[model samples]
Target chain A: MQKTWNNKAWFLVLPVLLLVAFSAVIPLMTVVNYSVQDTFGNNEFFWNGTDWFTEILHSDRFWDALVRNLSFSVIILAIEIPLGIVIALNMPKKGVGVSVCLVLMALPLLIPWNVVGTIWQVFGRVDIGLLGHTLEALGINYNYTQDPFAAWITVIVMDVWHWTSLVVLLCYAGLVSIPDAYYQAAKIDGASRWSVFRYIQLPKMKRVLLIAVLLRFMDSFMIYTEPFVVTGGGPGNSTTFLSIDLVKMAVGQFDLGPAAAMSIIYFLIILLLSWVFYTVMTQSDAEA
Target chain B: MARIDLDHIRHAYGAKPTRESDYALKEVHHSWNDGGAYALLGPSGCGKTTLLNIISGLLHPSEGRILFNGKDVTNLSTQERNIAQVFQFPVIYDTMTVYDNLAFPLRNRHVPEAEVNRRVNEILDMTGLSDMARRRARGLTADQKQKISLGRGLVRNDVNAILFDEPLTVIDPHMKWVLRSQLKRLHRQFGFTMVYVTHDQTEALTFADKVVVMYDGQIVQIGTPAELFERPSHTFVGYFIGSPGMNFMEARVDGTSATVGSQSIALAYAPAVGGAQKIELGIRPEFVRLQREGLPVRIGKVEDIGRQRIVRAEFEGKPLAVVVPEGMDIPADPRVQFDTSAINIYADSWRVGSEG
Candidate 1:
């Protein structure tokens, strides 16, 4: 017997495809159009052919921002991953204490990214902010507005405070999902506390940790709102991440053609990095 | 091999259990012989697992001492106890190969590489996992993972005891039988003190040399399968250890006869009762003889279970199950007779001494 096939199923997904086309694909095409062309005011466009791409590829500004983004992501990950695991380890397994700890950790995650930046901006001020005032009173000048080191400290601390909760939550979920059986097995094996963490807890948490790493990396790499609101990519562009640079080109300078090309480059970089992370992590999962 | 002694152990989760009834495990004092296979069998919320955890040093007893080979290990951790536990679910390192998972404990103790390999290989052979040694643990079936868990527990020769808490629950039925037999073989081969915890009566009966039946918060009975079946120390044991559990009929005992709702049944021995109020007759379905002439019973349903037909009937208004031969005919008026020699009398859930 021959089977009848219906092609109308494709129509069911048409709305979703249209939505994606409008929101993402159209915008991406516009960026691509701008990338290969030169535009002047009064809606005039000239085919510049690969000139913007070549310029962006050779530009030191793009490289510096990329390096800064990579370093920031690496540092944030290095600090957050282990810290999150440790926090998760120390958390109460069961009872009201678990709920209390969860709520407390989630408090920062609930605050919008821009709000987090605003809070940190006010809190790290030299004159009125408690932390800055206390540091000044201790005979230490901690002004994030003017000093590069202070600005870096402020940005790093702000990032940690805002995003560490995500890592914590993921690690916590992994920890909670581990049946008491594993711990029991570990105990019976005469496993030392460190060995238990290494052989049992660490391996079990690998999947979640990978997610936390990818999320933190993407967020830190594309960091614009917090640093822009706090330092305005300033104290001599010390805190100017890739997203900040991209925004400066696209919005501040308003050189639409070059900025659009830069935006495409930025988008490609994120897509490539995220793809790499996903592939590596998922491949390891498959191997395991 | 070491003897484990639980001395007056009592535990309560909350602070200061003031009353005698406040304890979760009420003063369990028992001794298990070296290299003995014991099963702690009970329903959930029966404190069987709690006692096992306490014995494993996962939980600290609120009161009393646990001695492993005469050394007090009540305050010690599970690592100090030198015990290997296989939990209900398989707890293997999913990222590691089966060989690596088995080799983990040995390597952690810094055992020689060749020796670790030899031991792991031997365990893999024992667990029927030799073919899948190089395969990662994550992709294997559930039962296979459980086998890895068992192998991990059994790999360490220096451990004093191996504890299993419902390790076969996730296993398929056929696999469960094979594993149980394998475990029995392992126990005999290794001569390790093994304490198995399960709610399944068949598993406990087949696996353990001595079964510890728990009820409420106390150890109801601890004996061999034969002893548990023939002479259950408590009513809970009589009810728990059998498939169609022992039927209890409320009766008035007088000399060598028990009157069950005006029907007098002869007993081999008289019930010892001076002030005992609630006397009950306990008898298993296997012991209840279905004869043509005896106390009248209304047969309600018959279940033909391959080997035998279980007759579900009402004897003097109380439900009773009688196991007869597979091809036996159910008479129009079936009469059941209690095997006098096998009958057990109980007073308030505890077995009373028989007066001959």
Candidate 2:
């Protein structure tokens, strides 16, 4: 058989390439452009060689925000992954309750980002909020505005309330796909409830748990609007995650070079972490 | 091993079943002996699986009691029944190695690790999976996974009985034969009371000491393969247990003869079918001898199936099949004669015994 090379096929990909360039590549190139150059007043620009990148890397503010983001991601994954699985396990397998439960779980995800933040902002106000008033009436020092610890708790709780449903929904999908035969066989084998969960349910839900963990990690790591609106990065920057800090530097201070450099570094870190997660998970899957 | 007695069991899926029509399993009352191998043979939706589940305690019967060795266990859970069942599709722990999978049932009962190891190794060797013992069950082929499921059941020693529900459905044809034989060998060697459920007649006949033939949520007959072949208690058993099933022809029977169309054939004995609503005479295709002179039949199609030829013919405006040996010549005027010893008389689909 003779093989034919068709160079004309490249024409079909032109629309997608143009779309990606305008949407992603072009904007990214502009950031790269700003990162590698310095600008003065009167539209004068000068070439700067990686100095902004080094400066951002050496700054304590960047490291602190990075640490905060990493810690937040770790904490939420630890809580949400197990919590979601537990909830999904307890969910009704059949009957009228399934749709009702699913809709209720999805309600939190449907709310817009800023609205969630606004709801929590007012809901946690020391003077007027129900939660704050209840806590204060119980003789607890509860003020998100002035106390860094309270602000951190409020932000973490808000993120968990908003994003844990994604995990629950994914785990629910995984749990339901397992056939009833496994459960029947487990019962016949005299497996206890914990053994059933560990051997049958957990292994069945592994793929979805990986997906949930990765999604929660990325989303929580890059979370901005909700925490920004609720805490306003106040209480001495206790809850200022990397995205919040990045927005403050880029949009507030208007330091384009440093901000652009930081953005690239943040993108690289996320890409690297996600790649590590994917490889580790899929490798374990293959081994199993 | 324990004798299992299903005493007047009936099951209905509905919460409140008001009538017999609502029942999934109409009724089942039989006792399976200790160390006996039995097969529940029926077509799909015939309540074979429901009966098996009831026996295994996966589903409690809505009526009647179940006894294991004379102890009432009707209210017992499946776990409390201490029975092992392999499902149609292999249900394996995906993350566990094959060894660990087989050991799981033992470990759950808190069996010591040394005993678990001994039993697991023996089963692994028996199932030809010793080499794959360390391999994850998820990575095995469909047949290997099925072997794992079977091995898990066999590894448990204290189980009252091991029930199989179409466990070889997922295996390849060749592997099905191999696994089925392995199961038979295991049943013989261990003498475990086994109840296997399958719709395939060959599987049922070959694997079980007694085949319980079911139809429309009722047991038509329970007998050995030879007895089922010779004397089916119901027309359904006669129809369901053969390659080309029994031929049933509408007939009018006198004391010692049955009239088919204008020809009256001699019977070995007078069947007591008095006041019967319907009368049918059934004889296997093997017993319908084709010859030069008998009741005249118009030949339709002759199918040569390697060892024998199946002559499809119309006998007095009714379809009939006659099996003839290979290379046998069909006479110019072909007809079929039913072996008098093999003729069975049915009254309203139920077989009629001989008169005193």
Q: Identify the candidate with maximal DockQ.
A: 2
* Model 2: how far residue A32 lies from native, Å: 0.3
Tens digits of per-residue lDDT for model 2 on B1-356?
Answer: 89999999999989999988899989999999999999999999999899989988889889999999999999999988899999999999998999999999999889999999999999999889999899888878888999999999999987899999999998888887888898889888889999999999999998999999999888889999999999998998999889799999999999999998888999999999989999999999999989987889989999988999999989989999889999889998997788999999999999999997
Residues B1-356 of candidate 1: C-alpha lDDT, one tens digit per residue:
78999999999987889987788898799998999999999989889888889988999999999998899998888877778888888888877889999998888778999999999999998889999999988888999999999999888998888888899999999999888998899889989999999999899989988999888889888889999999998888988888788989999988998899979989888778668778889999999988799989999999988899898999999999999987778888789888888999999888888664
Which digits, one per residue and each the tens of the lDDT, describe model 2 over residues A1-288?
A: 999999899999999999999999999999999999989767788999999999999999999999988998998888888888889989999999999999999999999999999999988887899998889989999899899889988988888898889989999999999998999999988889999998998988989888988889889889999889998888888989999899999899989899999999999999999999999999998887
**CA-lDDT, candidates in order:** 0.88, 0.92
Alpha-carbon TM-score of each model against the true structure: 0.93, 0.98
- All candidates: DockQ: 0.67, 0.85
Q: TM-scores of the first chain across all predictions?
A: 0.96, 0.98
